[model samples]
Target: SSLTPRPTGGISPIALPVLESLFTGNLQEARKLVFSQMLVSGQAAENGGSNNFIIGKRNQRALQVLSKSVDQDNCKTNALLYGGMHCKDLHRRLESMGYVAKKTEWRTAWSVD
Candidate 1:
């Protein structure tokens, strides 16, 4: 009998400087940082919600900066997550700005799952 293959989810490392610029309210720098980070992150296309919360939050900030920057349209998370490339671009921009740097030491996991 042939074994069925499971689809593997793709993971990419987040960029730091882009995130910093966004959180710092540097839109021009944030744009450059986001574009560069997208290139480096190694995903062929932008996958939505790879960084949703950060993007959504920062987007709110960007809106405050340029009141007409984004449309008044709204959608739920499910729609946003699978929306498409535009959504991905939006997400990437937000993620870069809002990402926090942290240091962590990992220990063995004891899973209750």
Candidate 2:
């Protein structure tokens, strides 16, 4: 999920229930809701949408709780769900999993494993 001109899914995750639904175990259903919704970050952010969890929102809490509940070493999903203050730590994690997380100023996206 980069913040540049490239697509970031910009909206579907936070503004919509897509992310919450997926984290809570309904990814397939969320897929249906998010179909064809991919677009530039500016467009979605302009409409009050976000790919990252809002600081004061429930999504942030959800991510925090989830990060703790799962074991980081054994879960790639946990690493992605981590909304921490350390980029190096996250980078190390991705490297361990044979994946790479690309950062683009305002967004991040994972490379295929």
Highest TM-score scorer: 1
Q: What TM-score does each of the candidates earn?
A: 0.23, 0.21
Residue 89 displacement in candidate 1 (angstroms): 31
Q: Which residue pairs clash in candidate 2? A: 1-108, 1-109
Q: What value does the lDDT take at residue 62 in candidate 2?
A: 49
Q: How close is each model in CA RMSD to the real structure?
A: 20.5, 15.1
Candidate 2 achieves a global lDDT of 0.48
TM-score: model 2 vs. ground truth: 0.21
Candidate 2 root-mean-square deviation in Å: 15.1
Error of 1 at 12 (Å): 9.8
Tens digits of per-residue lDDT for model 2, 1-113 = 23223165455334356666666788776775565345434445544434333433444454456555565544545434433333444455446656555653545553211
Q: Give candidate 2 misplaced runs (Cα > 4 Å).
A: 1-84, 107-113
Model 1, TM vs. native:
0.23
Question: lDDT score, residue 38, model 2?
Answer: 51
